[model samples]
Target: MSLTKAQIVENIQNETGLTKIKATDTVETLLEIIKSSLADGENVLVSGFGKFCVKAKQQRKGRNPATGEEMMLDERRVVTFKCSGKLREKIN
Candidate 1:
């Protein structure tokens, strides 16, 4: 099953013995930091988990399957994650 934000907060609280409020704040802060770093074109790495990075995709052509109409896909940035081998092993 996929873990939600609430579950992540709960896990942090349990593991760190922090109050729910503190745990929530810490998690939010960490997410904001990661977002800001990626916005600045930098990567964020959590050693035992994975690395987060922004990847750029080039403009491309595409078609609408339903309408059979051609369209152009604009270039854009996307967030990507590469899981650490240790974490992948544990999950599997």
Candidate 2:
């Protein structure tokens, strides 16, 4: 099952004994900070969990299957996540 923001906030509140509103605000602030860092082309590393980096995707040609029409996919920056080896082992 996928975890939602509400669930994350709840978990944080339960673990830290923080109020729900405080937990929610903390989670939101942290996510915003991470997003800002990625937007600024900076890498974010969460030790033992994963690393998040912005990667440049090259422009490429793609075809629409229904119409068989060719289109140019524009180059863009995307965030990529690389899981730490320890986390990978735990998952496996």
Candidate 3:
């Protein structure tokens, strides 16, 4: 099962003795910072965690699976994550 934001906030509240509101605010602020950084095309690196990068993709040709029709996909930026070696080792 995947962990949700509420679970994270609850865990933080339990572990740190913080109130629900404070824990939720902390999580929200942290997420906002990460989102803004990525939107600005700046990579965010957290030691012992991972790195979040903004990657750019050029316009490309794509096909619609439903109709098998060829279409052009517009260029866009995407966020990618690379876990730290320590995190990868721990997961393994």
> Which candidate has the highest lDDT of all?
3
Tens-digit lDDT track for model 3 on 1-92? 99999999999999999999999999999999999999999999999999999999999999999999999999999999999999999999
Clashing pairs counted in every model? 0, 0, 0
Arrange candidates by lDDT, descending: 3, 2, 1
Model 1 collision count: 0
Model 1 TM-score?
0.89
What is candidate 3's local distance difference test score? 0.98
CA shift of 84, model 1, Å: 1.2
For model 3, the run of ten residues with the poorest summed lDDT: 32-41
- Writing each residue's lDDT as its tens digit, candidate 1 over 49-90 gives 999989999999999999999999999999999999999999
TM-score of 2: 0.94
RMSD of each: 1.3, 0.9, 0.5
Candidate 2 lDDT tens digits, 1-92:
99999999999999999999999999999999999999999999999999998999999999999999999999999999999999999999
